[model samples]
Target: MGMEAYQAQFADHLPGGGPAWLSDLRQAAATRFSSQGLPDRKVEEWRYTNLKPVQAQLFALDAVSAGAAPPALLESSYRLVFSNGVLQSGANDLPTGVRLAGMAETLSESPGSLAAHMGQINAGQDLPLPALNQALSRDGYILSIDPGVMVERPMEVLFLSDAGTCYPRNLVLAGAGSEATVVEHYLGRGDGEYFVNAVTEIHAALGAKLRRYKIQQDAFGASHVATLAGQLGDDAHFENFDLNLGGQLVRSEIHMALAGQGAEAALNGVYLLRGKQHCDNAIQMDHVVGATNSHQDYRGILDDKAHAVFQGKITVRPDAQGIEGHQLNKTLLLSDDAEIDSKPELEILADDVKCSHGATAGELDETGLFYLRSRGIPEAEARQLLMTAFIAETVAHIGHDDVRAVMERLVGEWMAQ
Candidate 1:
């Protein structure tokens, strides 16, 4: 069914307590989606990536009964599982002193808190996929760390897609002087065609420290689109790493605002693509205050006919002096048909700032390959070794030891295939 039919058919079934503001927000988002439709290549931001694969498919609400149990997960003190866009509380465990609840439950219990930040990141935004998520989201989670509290363990959010279409919206808040780690994991289970559109909003108050990781491994037959937006407070620290290695067509957009003096932010990602896969990573860093530091680093490995795109932009406001901003993107093309488009941008209006951006795309070094083969290494093994070393630099930026190890292992598994 088209978006209009789907909206008219599933409006009543949407999760809510019939609040007027919530209803009005959903209606407005739905109308926006209908009027704008899906983004096309004509759009400047989306010019390099074609989204026809998502637009051609007819999406319907996923059947709850169709969901299978979640797969085995890594060890974490707390984990939340969402299957086919519905949170499965029966399978979750929470850490003490940390507030965790589904979006609907949070709205019912603490509507005022959610109301203040629910749609702040994506509300009335022009992004198509995020707009759709706002209009028809069925389930997600909210996590908050109490002020002056330190969480000793990492939190995990697992999203499993069995079939059909699912939209999940998540929010995370870190109180002042708090510190914590969060991991968002996505996995797909069936050969059935499906779509996953996800959105996440995060906020870090003054003196807070937040570390976030996004790991996506969807089914080869599915389509995935996601957006992550966050704002940092004075003297706060925020770091995020994205690892994408799945789905037929995938796009990940990340936006960060450095709104606080002395705040430091780091955004990094690594993606591996093969066969007919396509992935795009678009990142924007906004320097709204002086004496802030921001960095963006991304790497990609493309094989066969796979394609990838990286667009990184850093903007400094006129009043934001004494800023340090750097952006870099590097890619390795392993096949003749492999292709990548790399764009690095810097828009600086500040007079006293240090900012630079660059991008590089190329294939394996013939000289290095020859040297490895001369040392008695097989050609395939040699290629894998070089690729691993190439990506290790970016992976080292991940803060948590366990998470970094898991991501390294995942890259090895992909190389074996």
Candidate 2:
């Protein structure tokens, strides 16, 4: 079916009911989506990946059936789950200093609270996927941390999808001098084909510290698209890590802006794929002021006919002096037919900036494999060890001990494939 057919079927049933301003925002976003449509390879940002498969499939705007329960990724942590774009109020006993609510409830109670930050990040640009999400999103979570409040326990926002399409929009606001950790987990049930388009926005105020992680483990016949937009204030610290393991076609994009001086940001990711799976990760960091530091590191392991792409871009404005930015991307192709495309780019307009980027893609080292074999280790086990070590270099950057342990276990499970 065409875009018009899809829109005609569900545009009237889109969620979110608030003041006139929000209604206008949703209308404008829908118009934007209608004009731009789905991105194609001609677009420079999506030149390496194709969306024909997603376009050709017909997906319902709402879930047709209930999906299986989500995994225990954050069993002990405070959790809020959304099944088929509907929030489930189970296990929501949050600790002090943390406030979480669904978007529908917030819109009905206090719409003005969302007016200030909602649709504020993409005011200048027209990102079609995110615009589509805004137009059709049914449910998501809004989390806020009071100033100077520190939450000892981590939080998780889990999403489960069945054989349908779900657009989920999430927001995270960290007040000044506050500290918090959040995990965004996406999962799927059954072998049915589906599509997920998700968007998340985060803001960290002065002296605030925020750590966020995204784990995408969809069904084998699913297509996943997600965007993360973040802004950091003066002396604020923000760190994000992404892990992509499942889904037939997956694309993840991250955009971070260091709006205040002395702000620090870090982006790290890992993707493992086999068979005909395809995964693409794009990261863009903007240094808007001086004394800002940012880093980007990503690694991928591909086997069989899998394909992966990594693109990292860092921009330093003219007045953004004393900035330090670095990006590195590496991939290991475990089979002859496997492929990878790595692009590490830097655009520096400041004279006093220190920026560097590098990319490398190749197979395992024969010498290292031979050395391990001489030690009575099987070739398969030796290869797994080498690949694990290669990916550990990037995973070690994760700060939280529990989160890092989960990521390590996921890596080990991938290697066991």
Candidate 3:
């Protein structure tokens, strides 16, 4: 199906009667998406990933009611649940200085606040997927933290997809001197074909700290594409981590801009792929001001005929002196047929910047496997131990204990399989 077909089928059915600014934004986004359409391999950024599989299917807007149970939740945290892009449950006992509401509700109750930050980050970019999402998305959440307010507990957003296609657009705003953590968990329900196109925009004010984590565990027949864009203020700290374990075709793209001095950004991820799964991680870090710092670390474990791609680029502006940026990507190929394409780049235009990047892809260490086997450990157990140790560094970066424990358990389960 073409872009015109998609617009004709889903555009008119979108929710209406919102603020006029939002209406104009959606229309403009739709026009951009219609003109550009889905990206192809010819595009430089998308050269390693293909979207033909996504374009071949005709997805429906309405999803099948799966009613499946959600994965394990955090022991103590505020939670919001969405099934097939519709809100099913939300937390009502939010602490003082914290505000949370569904996108539709926020648009109705506080359109002014929602309008202030909705399309501000990626406004003039020629990004097609985000434009598509902005045009078709109907439901998501809006989370805001008041200045100087510290939220002790984490906020969890769970997305459960069963069938069909859903576009979820989310926004997060952290006021000056505030601190909080947010987790996005995506889980597939049944054996059905579906598509999940999600976009999340984040803003961190001066001296604020925000930690964001995502776990994508889609069904085997699902296609998941998501984009996360963030802008950081002076002295702000932003940390992002992704755990990709499922989906037939998956692309996780992240863009971060350190627009203020003394700001910092950390990006880390681990992906476990098997069978014929395809996973791609695209990262872009920009040091727009002086004295900014950014770091990227990603690890991948692939088996069978699984294929993975890691593309990361860090850019330092001409006047961005005293900047420090580093990126590293490592992959472990468990089977002879498995493949990985790792690319790490640094574009530095400043004279006094410390910027470097490295990428490595190879099989597991045979010497370490043999030493573990020599200790009377079974071969399979030794392989699992080696793989576990390989990803331990990235997992240790998680600030929350409960979330780190969950990641360990998931890694154990995946290794057992």
Each prediction's whole-model lDDT (CA): 0.84, 0.85, 0.88
Model 2 Cα displacement at 18 (Å)? Answer: 3.4
TM-score of 2: 0.95
Candidate 3 clash pair list: none
Model 3 lDDT tens row, 1-417? 566876785566555778888888888888888788889999988998899877754346775555855644687889887888877777679999998767887788877768888867962245888887887788887889999999999889988988888888899999999999989998987756788989999999999999999999999899999999999999999999999998999999998999989999999999999999999999999999999999999999999999999999898989999999999899999999999998887888999998888888889999999999999999999999999999999989888888889889998999999
lDDT of 2 by residue, 311-385 (tens): 889999998999999999999998999999887788989999999988889999999999999999999999999
The lDDT, on a scale of 0 to 1, for candidate 1 is: 0.84
RMSD vs true structure, all candidates: 2.3, 1.9, 1.5
Instruction: Give residue 273's error in model 1 in angstroms.
Output: 0.2
Stretches of candidate 2 off by over 4 Å are 1-10, 56-59, 123-125
> What is the TM-score (0 to 1) of candidate 3?
0.97
- Least accurate 10 contiguous residues by lDDT in model 3: 56-65
Models 1 onward score TM values of 0.94, 0.95, 0.97
lDDT at position 34, candidate 2: 72
Per-residue lDDT for 206 in model 3? 99
